[model samples]
Target: MPVTSVEKDLNTLSMTIVADFASPLQRLWDAYADPRQISKFWGPVEWPATFVRHDMATGGRSHYYMTGPNGERSDGYWEFTAVNAPHSFEVNDGFANEDGTPNDMMPSMKMKFEFEETANGSRMTNTATFGSVEQLQQLIEMGMEEGTRSAMSQIDAVLEDLATFAAGKGTELQILSDTQVRITRVIRGTAPQVWDAHNEPELMKRWLLGPDGWTMPVCEVAQEPGEQYRQEWENTKTKERFGFEGELLESAAPYRSVTTEKMIGMEGPSTQNELTFTPVDGGTLLTLVITYPDVATRDMVLATGMTDGMETSYLRLENEVLASAE
Candidate 1:
């Protein structure tokens, strides 16, 4: 998680930043390939960005805008010059008008992104070449150095989300049965690592919470069939508590498990959960199926924004547990 360097070369009129991430190279490449993922961290934390249109191929055009804190907005565009998946891509990056047209008044830079696999993880080098020293200095004065650094710092979170939603790991909700719904994700780790994260209470406390400022004060797991488990969390500020207790119905370490779950404070019949972990392309494909009493119960849970909340929690699991697992 160390940023190796951010350097500028006046002679070459280029700016470069090098950073390493504890993620696979494909996940890093995907951050640029998917526009929805790109929008998550494409701008500085203070000035969030929104992508109007994105086409990630050679000669494709990407139009986006970043809104400043004062309601001001800056539009930008990227014309892809070359694309080599999971390796490198080149683009002409510059300012754009509100109508998604290039603005002639501003200077454009030829930007290239290169990804390389390292012993620790993946290394990314971003190089932006200007036409002249003056142009480089102009952009430097415009806060490009600091702004780019701020934006790049958010890539770790994006990578985590990408790993979970990688190819074939559909984020789309799927109805499995009249009383069941399923969602699958590809986490960046082996089967054992994923199993540990689910069974180990200490690890569960790190990512299972729905949102920030929530702490899991009680996480007890009995990893044997017919054993009972309970997890409880509370909002630090409001002291609002929520949790679920369950009995392990079946246990097959690092592969599959089935459990019966009941929310402590919620009014509903206990649900059945089946989790299967399969190894795929050096990662773990986790399939989660939850069966409620009826379709109305399943739809009711979905309407509470549970999908988004669960997705967020899974992303945190990828970042905090899977990515760093040995």
Candidate 2:
């Protein structure tokens, strides 16, 4: 998502971003919520930031300084308005001193970050409300839009690296070594988040086929061996349901999970999938390996345009996650 001052009201500037990455919503949220990952990419390349006092709470404060390009330097402090970790965060941005005194010279502003996951990807909204017309003008003069676009590009790089890195490692859930179709995907979410995405109807609707008139029902989940998960996809237009079931082949909460999924709509043997998640430096890296029985089915899936689809999806997810983190 290109960062444009897409919407502005009064003296406030607002922007919308979409990021889709292989990662699930939870891990993406954590990266944004954590102070460590945030300090890395918060500001521009010229304005490298360092966190001084980061107490992330409802009334907490985050005071950071940007080493100015010229002799001019500034320190900013954010007073938390709300801290809904992994979902939404809003703050009051005010220039402050090292001693916690607000700098009256700089205008006060209210900044908000909201995250939402959609079927195709995830979307983020950022709003910065300036104190006066002068402050808004200052931001425009600074070329905020271009600066934001550059920052977002860095975000895309991070997301792509995370996806490729996760896929390169991790254990196979289904373990179909000799299968012809090499259904390989790195799971990019925690075991619990993935489990919820696969289990909960509403959450699944957000990122799945809900908007497209596809219904997934008759779904079940087994936490242990022999535990079964059965789900059916019903085409709203045709009124046809393709029932699918998978045995809980492996399960590790907050870590990894795999299931053998079999669908009735598609012919041939059941497609087995193993979803793996490993905790990396800052967040979880996920890989999902899928194996189809015959070459025809594999060809069909490859022809379905999944590579592009997944790329777009993952990019959007990453963007949204990183945006909300800011």
Q: Which TM-score value belongs to model 1?
A: 0.52
- How does model 1 fare in lDDT? 0.80
Per-residue lDDT of model 1, residues 1-326, tens digit only: 33689899988889998989998887777666554567777888888887655555566667788989998999999998887766888999999998679998998899999999999789989999999998898999999978877887898888776445665453455664478676666677877898899998889999988767899999999878989999899999999998999899987676678899999877767998877665545376666778799988888888897767777778889888777775
TM-score of each: 0.52, 0.45
- Residue 203, model 2: lDDT of 54
Give the per-residue lDDT of model 2 (tens digit) for 53-135. Answer: 45445665676766657845567788888977567789998778855568987677788877667564455567777767778
| Candidate lDDT values, in order | 0.80, 0.57
Indicate the residue-level lDDT of 131 in model 1: 95
RMSD of 1: 15.7
